[model samples]
Target: MPWFQLVANGDATDPNDYNAVGGPSCSGPNHICAIQASPNTNNKPIITTPLRNEMITALNTNSSSTNVQLRTNP
Candidate 1:
């Protein structure tokens, strides 16, 4: 298995270098997951949002739009 890191930026609110409070550090969880409740976070408007998804998809050779698919499926 591969490893990942969440370097802190001296901010305590953001995800610690180990996913303590928030995640990967950022302005905030001001996206859908924390607001709209759309369940469409796979493409969250944040960087780390799509980063992990894409990485996993690349390693598994799967489409990264799984959320999009779920939205269109019956």
Candidate 2:
């Protein structure tokens, strides 16, 4: 399987209020989006990409207010 990061708005208590790292907007009662992880030649997850890192950093910074979590789908 791949990995995904969940970004929840507000309290994160509602399952429909979250979205994937690189997915579409979490509108209505949509299911969890899947943002595939970037793996290296060794099949290991890598987050060195500038865009990914930027997104993660933004999420972390916003975590103080919202709920941002890093989850892996193994």
Candidate 3:
């Protein structure tokens, strides 16, 4: 799944400040899930508008002092 990792100064090798965002699964269709919502119907996960907004807020808040990196894999 795609994920976002927050690291200190955008340095992933630091191993000090690391926060991951993305890991939620739903069994049914059209179900609203949090963050990385994985549904059973398709490979592409549906990201609700509210969830997307929240993520953007979080990224903006943390990005001021740290670096947010969007990673495609675990």
Candidate 4:
């Protein structure tokens, strides 16, 4: 197992120095797995208005209007 040594910023080379570190802190449910609904806040104004989908594709990934499929075939 690997050991972690927490030393002061300026006293990193000092062998006699020891620093306290923080542990994991959580105040919610111990373990919970659920689908998270994330919203897309970044989108082009012109492409977002016409599309009915809430989560729009990112505009900075060299993507164009033709890259998106607006409909599904029956």
Candidate 5:
């Protein structure tokens, strides 16, 4: 998720009225509120290398085994 705040020249009615790509824009009669974003929750993994083929094979296998398996790089 993210967080935002209303800035000067920003209208409280329409927050998305102004384009907020290259920072805040407060140069009009219709006050534009500045929008800011907060850091996102870190759950995604940063993989620099390709995943092992064996792991992919096991995951693709449809077996009746009850034991769960975990794969990790050594």
Candidate 6:
């Protein structure tokens, strides 16, 4: 089945919080938003195409699947 996998570290899966579309991702509520981008300590908020494109390029994966990559300011 298609499922959301939370990669907490490199090639590692999160202990909890796995959903089809990464549901229950936010602790605030079970509510889903129509917004495309939401920045945070856990999730990577996407806004610009260049940024999105660069991320995809970095993924370096060859699959017709949706992937999400998160990073923090260092």
Q: Which candidate has the highest lDDT of all?
A: 2
- Candidate 6 per-residue lDDT over residues 1-74, each given as its tens digit: 12243333322222233323543232221121112233434554433465345445534542222233333222
Q: What is the TM-score of each predicted model, taking all chains together? A: 0.21, 0.27, 0.33, 0.16, 0.21, 0.23
lDDT of the candidates, in the order given:
0.27, 0.38, 0.36, 0.23, 0.29, 0.33
* Candidate 6 TM-score over all chains jointly: 0.23
Clashing pairs in 1: 15-22
> What tens-digit string does per-residue lDDT give for candidate 4 at 2-72?
11122323232222332222221212221111111212232112223333132144222323233222221
lDDT tens digits, residue span 14-64, model 5: 333323244332333322223333322342212112322322333456221
How many clashing pairs does model 2 include? 0
Q: What is candidate 2's lDDT per residue for 1-74, written digit by digit as tens?
A: 24343454432222233333443333333323223445446543354465355545545553211222333233
Work out how many backbone clashes candidate 5 has.
6
lDDT of 5 at 48: 16
As a whole number from 0 to 100, the lDDT of residue 72 in candidate 5 is 21
Query: 1-74, model 3: which lDDT tens digit per residue?
Result: 44333332533222223333564332322212233333324333344566456556644553211122233222
Superposed by TM-score, candidate 1 places the C-alpha of residue 20 at a distance from the truth, in angstroms, of: 24
Candidate 4: 10-residue stretch with minimal lDDT: 30-39
Q: What are the runs in model 6 whose C-alpha is more than 4 Å off? A: 1-44, 61-74
Give me the candidate number with maximum TM-score.
3
Write down the RMSD of all candidates, one decimal each.
13.7, 11.2, 13.9, 22.0, 21.1, 13.2
TM-score head-to-head 5 vs 6, winner: 6
